[model samples]
Target: MRVNFTIEGPPVGKARPRVTRKVTYTPKKTSQYEDLVRYTAINSFDGCFDHDEPVDVRIVAYFPIPKSWSKKRRQLCLINKELPIKRPDIDNVSKIIMDGMNPKMKRNKQLHRMVEVMRGIYHDDKQVTTLVVKKRYAERPRVEVRIKRDMGD
Candidate 1:
């Protein structure tokens, strides 16, 4: 089975977990982005992805050209002559999206509430046998995600 979806707006990288003497938690920005990814994935298709199958994931993150860049540079980026080589590294972007789609269960600690139960794309990120990630520039910034079962050779 294969699933495909796009998360609109600027792509966000996974932020490092904050640690205090008392407890550790995900940053608000990271948490919010993850929620968006999860919500989009859950609603993208009619059926849930299988749990035990090996999968391959590919992500392409598109960034908007900076206003400070000259017209020539902006044109280059738009045509793929130049790429996004700044912050929000590719690895971080991929990590957040994978975590967002994986099934999760946690107990104890903060008393807010547990994450809502939903059919997830896969059992865990570890089940991903292949991953491909890329970053580019676009007129409308967004992240495109593709997940598919891996049929081994």
Candidate 2:
């Protein structure tokens, strides 16, 4: 089976967990990005990969051309003459998306209980055996993800 979805926004990387005196927490940026991904995934698919099934994923992160750059430079970036080699490393970006597609639980401070943040697309990110990630520049920023069951040959 195969699933494809596009997230319309700036692509985000997974930030290292932040540690306070009492708790370790995901950064706000990362959490918010994950939430966006989760919302999109839920709306995009009706089923998910099984626990033992191997999965393959492809992600393409598109960044908007900087306004500070000259028009010519922006055109070059849009045409793939220049790549988005800046912040939010490819690995980090991949990690965020994978994690977002996997189930997550969080403590509900007000309710004093654990609540499901998302009913993910898979049991775990570990099910993914192959991942292809790339970054490019586009007129509008977005992230495109394609996922499929891997039938081992």
Candidate 3:
């Protein structure tokens, strides 16, 4: 089984700058970043799964290329299916998504582990992140048993 969801917005990365007040220092998610993750996860995961199942998470991040880029570069990107090899690094992107999914996965016994992850970048008209969760293994028997009682072969 595979679960799928798409969040359309600028992907929020995990890098957080720390702020110090006199003596104490605190690290927090940026307001914009926090809102982005919360809004997407809550809305998308709501009423999605009743039980947790083990999953191998896969993420494809489609980043929008700005119009500021030279026409030659833009055309090349569009024609060749170019990757967005720019900011909001891969690990940071993963962190944001994983945090959002915590509440949903915590409750389910079936979702014991998220075994694997594959991440990538691609060019698209708009910024979007697609999440694909695949079951770790087939729980049911793959082959059907046939009875020989009728045909005695």
Candidate 4:
């Protein structure tokens, strides 16, 4: 199955450390990442997916280009070493998307190994999250193998 939709929110990462206190720390329950996941899970059609098997997830993150950047950079007219680097790396964003699908995913299965995820980013005028999920199958690459035999044999 395929799910194509956009999520509007600031992308979050899992790198943040838990609160250090004597009281209980609800690590898995509260965080910006978790909040976004909760929101997405409720809105996304991702619930329709049956996660009893492996799935391939492809998501693209589009971040708003900083207005502070020079006109040349914004227009892509200057091709220099200056990169359009942004917070929350592609991998982190992908993780957030997977976590958002946690409710639909079976916990008994090793989610990481079973999931084939792909991610990308683009600096644009809008902040958007595009997600796509589909079934994964074995499509082994074709390789030609040949054996040599003696003519006299």
Candidate 5:
């Protein structure tokens, strides 16, 4: 899955420059399931500013989930008991994928929805933003799923 983000800013001297960050995930073909994620720092600052000028900088960064690590396979035992896996349900799948692994308070809803769709449990009216598939690891019989998110229009 791929997502693109755009940022706009005025000239550096006249106003504070805007900085945006982007990350991309590229998966490898080997069985290790290795993935390469790239981080890019784009400088929207115009070159008009003088080197000696003291400029106030405010950075706006957008960090997206890595593509390769987005989906992971693990034993179903890792999932929370509250999550429903017996029957195929989008909401349950979403909850399990998004909140099952982490004990954190907040969860990423968009990422959950995306995972649900990828599992063939739900279909979005619009195109799917991202997709992560869940399956058993080669050496283990345990089940696993992938988690990913995209900026939807």
Candidate 6:
């Protein structure tokens, strides 16, 4: 089937902005797996924004799941898995990120806030499949903190 839609723009100055048209086509009975694959490919960039920065740190948390899972399910799994890292009283989000780091390193407020924003993005349980952190090498942040869940027999 073919779908066409128009996006109307807000009025500016004395003239109305022209509307833009979008078109989409889909085949019949496509598997939900196709959506999952597309979602994974699109989101693969989430944790990779700062990868090339020499002074920046990057951490990646990978969950054991295939692309067949929906985006929401993946995010929920990440949130449920990483909930222990959340902080209650910190006004600045970066503090939470630093707090999530290894306690051995002295806490830096900036690092902590970065982690908090990253964590907050994943709180929805629909946007994340894994969480990764990248930081400067000097910080020596902990690479892995496992969250265990028991499946009852």
Each model's Cα RMSD: 2.8, 2.6, 15.8, 16.1, 22.0, 23.2
lDDT of 2 by residue, 11-95 (tens): 8899999999999988998988888898898789998789899999999999988889999999899889999999899999999
What lDDT score goes with residue 45 in model 4?
A: 45
Q: Which parts of model 3 have CA positions greater than 4 angstroms off?
A: 17-35, 46-52, 104-153
Which parts of model 6 have CA positions greater than 4 angstroms off? 1-55, 66-97, 102-153
Give the alpha carbon lDDT tens digit for every residue of 1-153 in model 5: 212212221101111124447633222221011100001111211122222322221122112222343234222223421222333233333333222222123235866532221111112212233434232112222222322233333
Weakest lDDT window of 10 consecutive positions for candidate 4: 141-150
List the candidates ranked by TM-score, beginning with the highest: 2, 1, 4, 3, 5, 6
- TM-score to native of every candidate shown: 0.89, 0.90, 0.49, 0.50, 0.19, 0.15
Instruction: Give the per-residue lDDT digits (tens) of candidate 3, residues 60-104.
Output: 555566658777776666554455666677766765555544442
lDDT tens per residue, model 1, 1-153: 789999999999999999999999999999888888888997886665566778989999999889999999999999899998898989999999999887555653576666636556776788999899999999899999999888876
Least well predicted 10-residue stretch by lDDT in candidate 3: 141-150
Clashing residue pairs, backbone N/CA/C < 3 A, model 4: none
Ranking by lDDT: 2, 1, 3, 4, 6, 5
Q: For model 4, how does the per-residue alpha-carbon lDDT over 43-131 read when each residue is reduced to its tens digit?
A: 54423433233344455454444557677665562332344355666566665555554532222364544332311121110222333
lDDT of each: 0.87, 0.91, 0.43, 0.40, 0.24, 0.27
Task: Give residue 103's lDDT in candidate 2 (0 to 100).
Answer: 81
Model 1 residue 7 distance off true place after TM-score fit, in angstroms: 0.6
lDDT of 6 by residue, 74-122 (tens): 5665555422222222222222332222112223586663332222112
